[model samples]
Each structure stands twice: as C-alpha cells, then as structure tokens.
Target chain A: MTLLSVSNLTKSFGGIVANDSVSFDLNEGDIYAVIGPNGAGKTTLFNLISGVLRPTSGSVQYAGRDITGLAQADIAALGVVRTYQLVQLFRQRTVEENVQIGFHLATRGGVGAALFRPGWVRRQERMVREKSRELLRLVGLESQAGLVADKLPYGQQRLLKIARAMAAGPKLLMLDEPAAGLDTQETSVLGDVIQRINDQGITIVLIEHDMNLVMRMATRITVLDFGKKIAEGTPVEVKVNPAVLAAYLGEAELE
Target chain B: MTLRSTISAKPQVWATALAIAVAVALLAYVFGRGGYVVTVMGFAVIYGVFVTGLNLFMGYAGQASFGQNAFAALGGYGTAVLCADYGLEPIVALVLSATLSAVIALIVGYPTLRLRGHYLAMATFALGLITYELSIEQSGLTRGFMGFSGIPPLGLGRFQLLSERAQLAVFILIMLLGVWVARRLRGSRFGRALLAIGESEPAANALGIQVFRYKLVAFVIAAVYASVAGSMFAHFVGYISPEVFGLSMVTLSFTMLYVGGIGTLWGPIAGAVLVSFLPQLLRGFRDMQDIIYCLALIVILIFVPKGLASLWSLAVRRSDVPAER
Candidate 1:
C-alpha cells in the first residue's frame, strides 16, 4: 500500500525553482532513497513534503490525506518525523533526556499537568523513563545516557539524532544526510541502525551523498538533477539509467 | 530533564534543602520584628517567586522577556487599586491581578513569540518602560510618585495575616511551592518539550512540539508568577510605587537568575536569597560595600559561572541517585 505520495510537488524560492514538479511515492515497509548531487533540490523536496516549506504548486499525501502546507509540527504529529542533516540535539540535555523530549507527541501533558505532577503524570513519567532507556539501548548510547548530548563525538551525535527522532514514534522517517559527518566505521554502524529501525515496520526515506550506503540500504532510489526527477527505480535499474549517469558524472560520462 | 533528580534526587540534597528551609524559618523567628536580616530574607523569597517564573521563560523555555516587570507592576497596581480603593479582599485581589497579567501576556506574546530569538525581549523592554511610565503619569488613579498605600493585609475573608513572622513564613511556603512547580515543569514531557524548543526550534517542531504555543504559554505563566509576587510585595509593605517595578526590577531579577543559576531547579531560590543579601552582607565595609559587592559578582561569575545552584552537585556527586518517579 502507498503510505506517502508526492504528486506534482513544486517549490520556488522567488525566481529560482528549487524543486520543479518532483513526484514520488513510497510503499508501506519500503526504504526509499532520494539521491542527487549538491543543489539538486533534494533538501528542497524534503522540506516541501515535510511541510517546512510551502510548495509553489503541488500536494503531499500521507496515509491518503493531503498534508501539503500543514504546519511542520502537525506533519510530525501525523508520524512523518525527520532528522536534520546537521546535528540538532538539545546540546545541554543528557542523551536520554534528548530522546525523551522526542516523545513529545507520544506523551500527553500540557502546562497545567506539568505544574502539579499528579498521579497520572508520575505514572506517565515512569513509562517515559523506561521507553527512553529502551530507545537509548537500541542506538547503543545507553551507557553515555548521562553525558550531555554535545559531549558526544560527532558521529555518535548523528546516531543520537536518529535515536531521538525514533522516540517520536514515527511512521515515515525522513533522514536528511544522516551520515554526513560520520567516518567509515560510524557510517556502517548507522546503516545498520537505519536497517534495524526499518525492520520495526516504519517506512524510511533518506537523502544521501554516500552512494554505497544508498545502494546497500535503499529498496528504491529516486534520482534528482537541477530540481527535476531524472530517473527512479530499484537500485539496480537506477545505477544503469543514462540520465542519472549524466547528472552525477556529467554528460561526458556517456562517451 | 529536571535538575530536581539529576542533581538532588538523592537523600543528601533533600536534607540540605529541608535544613535550609528550617534555618530560614528559625532565623525569621529569632530576628523578630523589623530586623534587617529578616526583612532581607522576606524580600528575597518574594523575588525568588518572580525569578522562578523568569527562569521558566528564559532558562527552561529558552526565550527572552525584558518586560516581566510590566506584569509585576500590573499585579502590584491591581492589588493596590482593588484592595485599597474598591475594598476587595487581598487574596481575591491578588488572584484577579494575576489573571489580568496572564491576559496581557497572551496579548503581547501572541505576535512576538511567533518569531524566534529576542524579539519578545524587545517587546517586553518596551512594555516594562511603558508600564513604569503609566504608573507615574496616571496620577489620578495611581497617585503618581506619591505612591499607592493602605493596601489591606493578605487573608481569608475576615481573618487578617498581620504578624511579621507569619508573613515571612507564608512567603517561604509560597516560594517553596513555586520552586516545586518549576521543578515539576522541568522534569515532565512538557518540560522536555520546552527545553527542546529552547535548544532547537526547528528540530523540536519536526518532533511534533508546537513551538509557538509552548513559548506563548511559558511567557504567560512567567507573567502570572511575576504578578503574584508583585501582589505579595504590595501587601507586605502595605504600599507600592512606580520605582519598585521599573527596569531596575528587570536588572535585579536577571542578576538573581544568573547568580543563582539560569536553568537549574533551585536557581531562582538560591539566586534570590544570595543576591538579595549580598548588599547587606557587605554593609560592614561601609564606604567599600558597593566596590566589594561588584568585585564579588565578577569573582563569582568567573569562578562559579553556573551559579550557586550547581554548588551542591560539585559538593556531592553522589551515586545511587534514584530515578525521579
């Protein structure tokens, strides 16, 4: 079943068209990768779909409902959570606390309830502690849970971002360059972490510069060039597409 | 997470806090009426509540507000006018004043809070100054620089709370309750969401936290706290003037917040007590008091940059700190 569909998705920044008529659909339980060179409108496409930016003209459908132009928080509440390309962890917060904050949607309590901390709030907090600890263990940061988030190494911080986002109880996880600053060993570990999360039945969409990771993890690949979709298919087919080849290696690659 | 457990979830910290509270009460009792130390302590607790609210806005929520004094003035004036002029009960007057402050906070926060950064501070700065001006210029109602007096003592209907020691005790109780609320706020899902917003607005939004609503709510809550503190101040002195709730109040609260600790659970209380008494502590130096006080601030800022609230953690990095239940 189609979980998310972007139909005729277009976005323009003043006169510059950042994402020109981009369209894609992800099936339930499939890992989708959107790959492109720098300035290929990859992030722009993510922004439009995630409701961070309004499309000049287009629509984003999640679970068969139109979600374009909705608030970023509202989109996230519908289970379409995304991690930023750069690390955005709450730096002063401990690792476990960082992940617990991601449980904003999963837990229910407003300002009033937070003040008194009645029986229900305490019970809710106990569950939150257990659940957050479980997530920390998942990403293998449980030991460093007491350390402040910024105190972590860069690659581990990236992994921490994933753990935090996962705590949001996402149905569709959109990762923006999750492996950007990661070393080779860290990158491999992250790939495994992404796989483990995908196995838990959440659909994954990622934009990546690392072709190897993309080819290995992505069940489907969409190629973008100059704000337009050049080609899209399974990893094997996208690898051989001439337009994708020209876009990545320049048109001279064909010769 | 709330510093409540992260630092003081252990028994030692609890004992330290209880001992401090009891000592305060003891001192208040021994000092009796019109003692300088007791007066300073009483004022400290009032400012503690005000700064506690400010901490929620600036420390936990990660927003700025220069106009909190505006709300304080509102509470002070509201209580004064309602109790003194209209013959309303002091308790009812205080509640009414706080409610009015909340409404004003909502009105101011709605637009300024939408945009991130210190825009709220800019708006609040104007508000604080404007409120100060109104108190001076509205001579017909407020009596201008002559000050507003004859505000009734706080009580339940016919019962009057007139004793100096009793008032100090009540101040301590209310201050403790305010700290408890702030600690509860810092440790909950709501608290986590707020700190998340303070750290990274975009990331927080992508995680399903409503940044605008939360900021606005934080702003209003802080204002209500300021309002209540102002009302108490009015009743404590039985008079109030425009001079009390000016930019100086903002400066005082800011100093208290940083000196005590910006984000920690006990920061406000620690800061209020210490900063309130710092001037008095140096009074023995007479001619050098101001110089010594400024030097003390600089030294503390350099050596204990996190403020006195963090002193306990350094003193006892105790193990087996039970998780907050």
Candidate 2:
C-alpha cells in the first residue's frame, strides 16, 4: 500500500531548479532511501514532500489525499514528520522534556486546562512521561534524561532528535541526513534504531550519504541526479544501474 | 559565571514567590490604610498581571510584541466607557473589555507577528501608538486627553473594594491568580509548545505544532492580560487617560520582566516588586534618582542578564548538585 506518492514534483528558486520534476512512491512498512551526490537536490526533494517548500508544479498524495501547498504542521498532523539535516533540539529543555514536546498532538489540552490541572491532564501527562522514557530507552538516552538537550554529545543529540520525532506518534517519518555528523559506530547504532522503528510498522524515507547504511537498510532505493530521478529499485538492482553509476562518476560511493 | 541562564523554575523559587505574595498583602496594611505606599504596591500588582502576560508572549513563546499596551488601552477605555458613561457594572466592563482586546489582538497579531526581531517590534510599537492616538482622537467616547473620571470602584453586587486595605487584598489575589494561570500554561503541553517555538520554529513545525496559530493565541492571551491590567489601573486610580497606556508602559513592563526573570515562572512578579520598590528607596537622592536607576539596571544587565531568578539559582547552587544549565 502506498503511504506517500510524489508525482512530477518540481521546485525552483528563481532560475535554479532545486527539484526538477521528481517523482517517487513510498510504500507502507518499507524502508526507502533517496541517495545522490552533493547538490543532487536530495534535501530539496525532502522539503517539497514534507511541506517545507511549495512545489512550482506537481502534487504529493499522502494516503490518497492531495497535500500539495499545505502547511508543514498540517502535513505533520497528517502523519508525515521530518527531522532537519542539522539537529534542532529545544536547546534549553531537559532531554525528557524535548521528547515530551513530540507528544504534543497525541495529547490534548488548552491554556485553560494547563492552569486548571484537571484530573485527565494529570493522567495524560503521567502517561506521556512514561512513554517518553520508553522512547529514550529505545534510543539509549534514558540516563541522559535529566541533562539539558544541548549538553548531549553530537551523536547522542542526533539520536535524541529521532526520539523526539518519535514522540509525535508519526505513521511516516522522513529523516533528513539522519547520519550526517556521526562516527561509524554511532551510524551503525542509528541504522539499528531506525530498523527497529521500521519493524514496528512505521514507514520511513531517509536522505543519506552513507551508502553502506543505505544498502543495508533500504528495501527499495530511489536515486536522483540534479533534481530528477535517475534510477530506483531494490538495493541489488540499483547497485548495477549504469545511470546511477554515471551520476556518481568522480564521487563514487555506489560500490 | 555559569549560573546565568536559569530557564526552568524549580519548586524552591515558587515557594519563595508565595512567601512574597503573603508579605506584599501584609505590606499594604503595614504602612497603614490610605497611604501612598499601598497605592504604589497596588500599581505594582496591576503591572504584575500585565508583565505576566508579556512574559508569556516574549519570554515563553519566543515572540516579540511591543504593542501589548494597545490591549491595555482597549481594556482601560472599554471599562471607562462602559462603566463611567453607560452605567454598566464594573465586573461586566472588565470581561467585555478583555473580550474586545482578544478580538483586536487576533486582527493585529495576524499581520504584525509575521515579522521577526526588529520588524515585529516596530509593528507592535506602531500598534501601541495607534491605540494611544485613538484614545486621544476619539474624544467623545474616550473623553480625549481630558481623560475620564468617576469610573466606579471595582466591586461585585454591592461590596465595593473601597478601602486601600480591601483593594490591596484584591490586587494581591488577582496577581497570584494570574501567576497561577501563567504557571499552569508554562508547565503543561501548551507551554512546552511555546518554549519549543521560542527555541526553534522549524523544529516545532516538524513536530505538528502550529507555530503561527500558537503565536497568535499567545498574543491574544497576553493582550487579554494587558486589558485586565488596564481596567485594574483605571478603576484603582478612579481615572482613565491616554497617557497611562502609552509607549512608556512598554518600557516599564519590559524592565519589570527582565529584572524578575524573562522566562522564569516567578520573574514577572519578582521583577515587578523589586523594580517598583527600588524607585521609592532612591527617592531620597532626588535629582540623582534616574541616574541611580539607570546604573542599577545596568548592573543587573551586566551581572544577571537572565534576571533576579538567575540569582536565585546562584543562591541555591551551594546546597544542590549543579545540573546542566
């Protein structure tokens, strides 16, 4: 079942086409990866689908709903959540508090309820706290719960972002360079954590430069070169695709 | 050196604020009734409510709004017009005026909040000026620069808060209530979203938090708070005028918010009390008063940039294990 479908999506910044008529489909319960060299518009494609940028032309159908031109939060509420290429934590809050922010939409209360502290709000808060801890444990940051978010090491911060994003209870998680600044050790753990997330029935699409992680995790792969889809298939098929190889010519990581 | 950024309010700070609340209520009676000191404390509490609202917007939600006085003017004049001119109940005037402020905030915040930093500040500043001008220009309704008097004292049914003693109790109660409400909003889901927006808009957006909607709601909430403060000021002093809710209020409240702790829970009230009382303490200096005030603020800005609550953290640092700032 297709959870997300991008057809003829194109975005241009003046004369430069950041994303030029890209097309792809993300199926439910599958780990999909989009890979390309620098300036291949991989991040641009993520932005267009996640509602950060409006496409010049083309439509995004998420669960058969045409979500083109919708606001980023609206798209997220519809279950498509993304992370930044550069980590964006609350910076001042505790690690646990950062994840609690993710559970925002799942819980319901207004300004009045916050002050009133009704019975239900208390119960909901306790439940979210427990759930937040469970997520931290999932990402192995449970002990760091009391520490400020920014005080965490860079690798842990990246993992913290995943935990924070997971708090939103997303059906589809789009990760932008989830392994951008991590060591090989951190990257391996990240791959395992993501697979565990995928195993639990959430669909994922990640833009990554790490070919080994991609080749290991992606059940299906989409390759883009200069804002257009150059090749896409199962990992084994795309590894042998000549166009994908040509696009990665001097910058070869397609081995 | 590391004690500067005290973002979260611990239970200890709240206990201290409550103690101050009790003391402030007693303060009105300590100097005796009908004295000038109670009037000063009364005004401080009123500004407490106003700055509480401002803190919610600027401190928590991480949005800048310079025009909250617009709503205060709305609340003040709304109460004056309804009570003094039309013979409405004071309580009804307060509620209706706050509602009116909310509507105005919705319309104004929509356009003004789109800008960030200096631009947003300039837009809100203009909004405040426009409201001030309206208060003066709409002579028939607002009574113009001549001002409006004979506004009824705050009361319900037949019990008027006539005495300075009675008014002080009422003011303290209202200020504490305002603090409770702000605390509730800050500690819960609503507040977390605001803090997130304050830190990073894009991150909050990606998490399904509506950044624009949250900002507008915060602005409206802050405006309602300003309106209540405005009405309280009008009724407490028994007069309403354009100058009371002018740009100077913007300056005064910002001072109070920073001195107390911009984002800390007790900061607004703490700042309000200290900044309000400091002026009277320096009254002996006469001509040097403003100079002393400027130096004091500079000292605070240089040493405790996060506000007085940051000092509270410093005070408690010895007894407790230091956590990540």
Candidate 3:
C-alpha cells in the first residue's frame, strides 16, 4: 500500500520552477531513496512533500489523505516529519533535551499545568525523558546525552538530528542529505542505523548524493533532473536507466 | 527517573530562590536605613519581573520585541484609568489592566510576530512609538503628558501597602512568584516548544510545533507580565506617566535581560539588582556612571556573551569533572 503519493506536483519561485510536474509513490515499509546531482531539485521535492514549500499544482496524499498545502507543523502532526540538509539540533540544549523536544507532539500539558507540576505532566515528562535516552542509544550517542548538542563532532551532530527527528514518532521520516559530509566509518554507522530504523516498520524517504549507500540500502530509487522525474523503479532499474545516467553524466555529474 | 524525583528538581530551584529572597530581605531590613533604599530595591524587583517576561519572548521564543514598554504603558494606564478615574479596587484594576494588555498583544502579535529578525524588531519599535504617541494624545483617558496621578495604593480593605517596608515585602513576594513562574515554564513542555522555535523555527515546525501559535502565546504571556509590573508600579507610586514607560525604559529592560542572561531564570533578577544599584554606587563619579555602565556591559558581552549564568556554569563545571569546552 502507498504510504505517500505525489502526482504532478509543481513549485515555482517566480518564473523559475524549482519542482515541475514531479510525481512518485512511496510504499509502506520501503526504504525509498531520491538521488540527483547538484540543483536537480531533490531537496525541493522533499520540501514540497514535507509542506515546507507548497506546490503550485497537483497534490500530496499521505495514507489516502490529501496533505497538500497544509502547514508544516500540521503535516508533521499527521506523522510526516522531515530533517533538514543542515544539522538543526537545539544547540544550547543538552543532547537529551533536543531529543525530548522532538517528543513535543507526544507530550501534553501547558504553561499552567507545568507551573503547578501536576502528576500527569510529570508522568509524561518522565516517559519522554526515557524515550529520548532510548533514541540517543539508537544513534550511538547515549553517552553524549548530557553534553550540549552543538558541542558534538560534526558526524555525531548529524546523528543527533536524526535522533531528534525520531522523537516525533513519525510514521514517514523524510531525511534530506542525512549522510552528507560523513567519513566512510561514520557513513557506515549511519547506514546501519537507517537499516535498523527501517526494520522497525517506519517508512524512510531520503535524499542523498551518496550513491554507494543508496545502491546498498534503498528498496526503491527515484531519479530527478531539473525538477522533473527522470526515472523510478527498484534500485537496479534506476541504476541502469539510460536517461538517468545521461542526465547525471552529461551536465551534473554524480560524485 | 521516577515521577517523584522528576517533580522534585524544579521545586528545589524555586525553594532556593525563595530562601535567597527571604535572606536578602532580612539583610536589607537590618542594614538598610531609609525609605530611599527600600524604594530603589522595590523598583529593581519590579524591573526584574518585567525583564523576565521580556526574556520569555525574546530569549526563549527567539523573537525580538522592542515595544514591551508599550505594554507596560498599557498596564500603567489600564490600572490608572480603572482605579483613579473609576474608583474601583486596586487589585481589580491590576487584573483588568493586565488582561487589556494581553488582548492587545494577541491582536498586535498576530500580525507583527509574523515578521522575522530585524523586521519584527522594527515593527515592535513602531508599536512602541504609536503607544507612546497615543498616551500623549489621548488626554481625557491617559491624562496626556501631564501624567495620571492619585492612584489608590494596592491593599486589602482598610490596610494599604504605603510604607516602603511594606511595599518592599509585597514586591519581594510578587517577584519571587514571578521567578517561580519563569522557572516552572523553563522546564515545561510549552517552554521546550518555545526553545525549539527559538533555536530553529523550521525544525520546530517540522517537529509538529505550531510555530506561530507558540510565538503568539509567548508574546501574550510576556505582555501580561509587563502589564502586571506596570500595574504594580502605578499602585506603588500612586501615579502613571507616558514618560515613565517610554524608550528609555525599553532600553533599561533590554540591558537587564542581557546583563543577566536571556534564558536563565535568575539572570533577570541578578541583572536588575546589579544595574539598578550601579548608579547609586557610582554617585561620586557623576557623568562617569553611564560610561562605566556601558563599559561593564561591553565587557560582559565580549567576555561572557551568555551572561552571568554562563559564568556560574563555568564555575560549577570547573569544580566538577573538568569538562571539555
């Protein structure tokens, strides 16, 4: 069954089309990968699907519900969450605090209840705290949970962002360049974590320039070029498509 | 940890603050000799409350607001008109005025909070300007630049908080309450949401946080706090004036927020006490007081941009674990 479906989605920045007539379907429990060279609109497609940017035309359906043009937060509330290309951890907060913040939707109580310290709020808080620790362990940063978020090494910061994203309890987690700027060892660690996350029944959609990781981990792959879908199929089919290879090699070469 | 231990952490902070406030009050009563000292301390406490409110918006929510003084004016004028003109109970005046300020914040923040960065700052600054002008132009209601006077003292029945000692005690209680509220908020889910927004609005939105709604709530809460402080000021002084809540007051509150640190619960109080007394301490220096204050602020920003909390944390870190920078 399709977990997320986008049909002919188009986004324009004035006269420039960032995403043009893009269409794809993500199935439930599939580790889907989106790959393209620089400025091929991979990130823009993520933004449109994630509701950070509204499509000019067409629609996005998540679990048979139209989510097109919904506010980003509202989309997230419906269990569709995205991570940014750049790490966006809450820098001043501790690593665990960053993860706890990700549990915003799961937690309840407001300013008045918080001030009074009611039993329910305290219970919810404890649950979130324990869950945050569990997430840290998943990202292999459990020992660093007490440290400030930004103080983590760059590769660890990327994992921290994923841990925070998971705190939201997302059914569909869309990651933009999660493995960007990682060494071979770090990338392998990230791949292992991603596989574990996918094994747990959460659908994963990611935009990545790391071809090796994409080939090894993706159940299916979609290729985009200059805002249009060039190819979509299983990883093997996408890799051998003549149009996909020409688009990458002729102008924007994939590293 | 279990629920019992988790709940204990926040209360411990508030208990410590209460203990410190009581000790400080006792010390002042014993060592301080005159009404002037008490009045100064009272104003310092009031300003601390105001700055703490402002920090909730600017520091925690990651929004800049320059027109908090306008809300403070609304607060002062709200109480002044309700009590001095209509002869209502002073406590009633306080509640109504603060409500008025919050309603105005909701209306204004809806549009103004949408603008980010410097644009939001400019918009709030304009709001301050408009409020100041309205206070001056609306003569019948605000008494214009001539000032609104003869506000009844805040009290219960026949008893009033007129004496400096009584006012100081009341202000201390109120300030401690404000501190307690801020501390509780810092640990709350709402506070975490605000901090998330402050750190990254886009990330917060992606995490299912209603960014604008949270911002509006923070703006309104801060507005109400400013209004309450103004109400306290009006009843304490028995007067209200536009000049008292103008550009200079905005600058003063901003300085306090910075000197104390933006997000910490105790920063505002420490900053208010220190900055409020600096001029009095430097009385012999005459014009040099302003220069010294500016220099001290510069040093604080350059050396410890995180404010006094950073310094305190550094000390604590040094004593325990020799942590990495």
Candidate 4:
C-alpha cells in the first residue's frame, strides 16, 4: 500500500523554482532513496514533504489524507518526521533530554497534562525517558546519554539526531544527508543502523550523495536534476539508465 | 567506583542546601530588620517577583520585551482605580489588576509575538510608550499627570498592614510564592519547551512544539506577575503614578535579568537586591555615585557576561570538589 503520495508538487523561492512538478508514491515499509546532484532540490523536496516549507502548488497525501500545507509541528504530530542535513540538537540539553523533547508530541497528555503534571503526566515522562534511553542504545550512544549533545563527536552528533527523530515514533522517517560528513567506518555503521530501523516496520525516505550506500540499501530510487525528476526505478535500473547517468555525470561526460 | 558511576550517583545536595540556607537568611532579615531596611527589603521582594516574570519571557522564551513596566503600571493603576473609585478591598483590587494586565498582554502578544528579534523588541518598546501615554492622557480614569493616591492598604479583618514590619511580612509571602512558581515552571514541560524554543525556534517547531502559542502563554504569565508586583508596590508606597512605570523602570528590570543570569530561577532575586540596594551602598560617594554605578555595571557585563549565577556556580564547584580530584 502507498504510505505517502506526492502529485505535481511545486515550490519556488521568489522567481527561482526549487522543486518543480515533482510526483512520487512511497509504499509502506519501503526504503526509498532520493538522489540528485548539488542544487537538484533534494532537500527542498524533503522540506516540502515534512511541512517545513509550504508548496507553491500541488498536493501531498499521507496515508490517504491530503496534508499539503500543514505546519511542521502538526505534520510531525501526524507521524511525518524529518532530520536536518546539518545536525540540529538542543546544544544546552543532554542527549537524553534532547531525545525526550522529540517525545513531547507523543506523550499521553495534551496541554492539560503538560501544565498540571498529574499522575499520568509523570508516568508518561517516565515512559519517555525509558524510550529515550532505548533510542540512545539503538544508535550506540547509551553510554553518552548524560553528556551534552554539543559535546559529542561530530559522527556521534549525527547518530544522536537520528535517535532523536526516532524518539518521535515516526511512521515515515526522512533523513536529509544522514551520512554527509562521516568517515568510511562511520558511514558503514550509519548504513547498518538505517537498515535496522527500516527492518522495524518504519518506512524510510533518505537523500544521500553516497552512491554506494544508495545502491546497496535503497529498494527504489528517484533521480532528480535541476528541480525535475529525471528517472524513477529500482537501483539497478537507475544505475543503467543513460538519462540518469547523464544527470549524475553530466552531458559532456556522457558524450 | 567507576568515574561514570561516581559522577552519576551523587545527589545534588549542595544546590538543595544552598537554597535552604538562602531561604532561612531571607526569613531572618524579614523579621530582624526595622524601619528603612525593612522598607527596602519589601521593595526588593516585590521587585524580585517583577523581574522573575520578565525572566520567563526574555531568558527562557528568548524574546526581549521592554513593556513589562507598562504591565506593572496597569496593575498599579488598576488597583488604585478599583480601591479609590469603587471602594473595593486591596486584595480584590490586586486580583482585578493582575487580570487586567493579563488581558492587555493577550491583546499585545497576539500580533507582536509573530515578529522576530529586534522587530519584536521595537514593537514592545512602542507598546510601553503607548501605555505610559494612555495612563497620562486618560484624565478622569487615570487622573492624568497628577497621579493617583489613597490606595487603601491591605488588611486581614481588623489588623491592617500599615507598618513597615507588617508590609515586609506580606511582601515576603508574595516573594516566596513567586519563587515557588518559578521553580515549578523550571521543572515543567512547558518550561522545557520554552527553553527549546529559545535555543532554536525552527527546530523546536519541527519537534512538535507550538512555538507561537507557548510564547504567547509565557508573555501573559509574565504580565500577570508584573501586575501583581505593581499592585503590591502601590499598596506598600500608598501611591500610584505613571512615572513609576516608565522607561527607567523597564531598564532597571532588564538590568536585573542581565545581572542575575537570564535562565536561572534564583538569578533575578540576586539581581533585584543588588540593583535596588546599590545606591544606598554608594550613598557616601554622593556626587560620584551615578558614575560609580554605571562603571560597576559595565565591569560586571564585561567580566561576567552570564551574570553572577555563573560566578556563584564556579564558587560552588570549587568548594564541593577538590581541585586535584
């Protein structure tokens, strides 16, 4: 079943088109990769889907519901969560605390529970803490849970950001350049973790520059060039397509 | 005893002890002092409540506001108008005044909280000016420039708090309540959300926090605090004037927030006492007092950018843990 569908999605900043006429369907429990060269509107596509940026035109349907222009928080509450290409952890708070913040929307109580701190709120807070610890353990940062997020190593910060997003219990997790600055070993570890997370029944949509990682893990791939979709197929099919090759290697290189 | 186990096992006993000690000292001062000292202490206690409210908006929420004094003025004038014109009790006047200030905050915050950074600051500053002008020009309601007087003092049955000692007791009670509220907010989810928003608005919003709604709530809560402080100030001083809640008063509150440390709950209390009593401490220097005050502030701002809380925390760290250990 399709978990998310985008139809004729278009976004522009002033006169520049960032995402133009983009359409795709994401199936349930599938690991989908979005690949493009620099300035191909990959991040813009993620932002549009996550509700961080409103579309200039077109529609987005998640779980058979249209959610084109919802606010980021509302979208997040509806189980669509995205991570930044640049890690954005709460620097002053501990790793555990940062993860717990992501659990804020998932807590049992609404505003009343938050304000009043009833018995249920305390229980919910305890549950959140336990879940946060579990997420930390999953991402191999359990030992560093008490450490301030800013104090963690750059590679660990990336893992922590993924763990933080997972704390929200998202149905669809969109990672923007999850392995951007990692070393070879760190990238391998990240690839393994992403695979494990996907195996746990969470649909994954990722934008990655690492072609090896994309080809090895992605069930399907959507290729983009200069704000338009160039190709959509299985990783093997996309790797062999001449248009996809030209988009990646450029027309002169193809010639 | 592994390093992690040792560090994690130790309770925050020192912070608890220090808080208790300070509470005791405040209690001793309230009961021991007489005349002017008690009066000054009363002012400090009320101002402490006022500054803590400002701290919630500026420090935790990361929205600078210069209009807290306007809220304070509304509270003071609300109390005076209610008590003098309507013959209501001071207690009733206090509640009504706080409600009035909160209503005004809602009106102002709805449009103003949408603005970012300096635009928000400038908009709130204009609000402060408008409130001051309205208080002065409203003539029959606010009594114009002549100022309002005869705000009946607070009382419980036959025992009215007319003396400095009695007023000090009431002020202490109010300050304790303020401290309790601040501490509660510090531990609450709403407080954490505010801190998150303060750190990064877009990140917090993406994490499912209603950023604008939280900001508006913080703004109104802070206004309510200022109003309560204003009502207490009017009753304590036995007068209410538009000038009491002017730009200088707003600056004084901002200085308290800065000098104390922005995010900490106890910082404003330490700041209010220092700024309130600095003039008396420099009374001997008469002609040079203003110069000395400005210099002290500049030096503190330069050396202790995080304010006295950072220094105090450093001192506590040194005393609690051995230098080599």
**Model 4, stretches more than 4 Å misplaced?**
A7-21, A53-59, A68-71, A108-115, B1-11, B315-325
TM-score leader: 1
lDDT tens digits, residues B1-325, model 4? 2234356333334655775698688668656867677777878888999988888888888998988888999889988898878978888888999998889899989999999899999999999999999999998998888888887787755668978788878887888788777766755677778878887887787778889989999899899999999998888888877888889888898888788777778778888887887777888899999999988888988998877676655544433211110
Error of 1 at A74 (Å): 3.0
**DockQ, every prediction:** 0.56, 0.50, 0.49, 0.40
Docking category for candidate 1? medium
lDDT of 3 by residue, A1-255 (tens): 999999999999999888889888999999999998789888889888888788899999999999999987788888887898854778877788899898988677888887988888889888988898889989899887767787889889998899888988889999899888999888999999999889889999999999999999999999988888899999889988988888888845643
Summarize candidate 1's per-residue lDDT along A188-253 as a digit string, tens digits.
999998999998999999999988899999999999998999999999999999889899889875
Q: What fraction of the true interface does each of the listed models get right, in terms of native contacts kept?
A: 0.81, 0.79, 0.72, 0.37
Per-residue C-alpha lDDT of model 2 across residues A1-255, encoded as one tens digit per residue: 999999999999999998888888989998999999999999989888888889999999999999999988788888888888864899888788899999997889978778788899999999988999999999999887877787899889999999998888889999999988789999999999999999889999999999999999999999998888999999999999889888988546644
- How far residue B220's Cα lies from its native spot in candidate 4, in Å, is 0.7
lDDT of candidate 2 over B1-325, digit per residue (tens): 1122253445557746865686667574545655777888888899999999998899988888888999999999999989888888888999999999999899988987888889998999999999999999999899899999988888887778888768777888888888888888888999999999999988887778888989999999999999999999888989988999988899999999888888877777878978888888799999999999889988988887878777665554442222221
- DockQ, structure candidate 4: 0.40
- Report lDDT (Cα) of residue A200, candidate 2: 88
Q: Rate the local accuracy (lDDT) of all candidates.
A: 0.86, 0.87, 0.85, 0.84
**Backbone clashes in model 2, listed as residue pairs:** B260-B271
lDDT of 4: 0.84
By DockQ: ranked, best first: 1, 2, 3, 4
**After best superposition, candidate 3 residue B19: deviation in angstroms?**
9.8
The complex in candidate 1 yields a DockQ of 0.56
- lDDT per residue, candidate 3, B1-325, as tens digits? 4332254556545655764786577446633676666677778888988988998998889899999998999989988898878878878888998898999999999999999999999999999999999999999899899999998877876778777678777877888898888878888899999999999887787677889999999999999989989988998888888899999988988888878777777777777877787677777778787798788789887987776655545543432211111
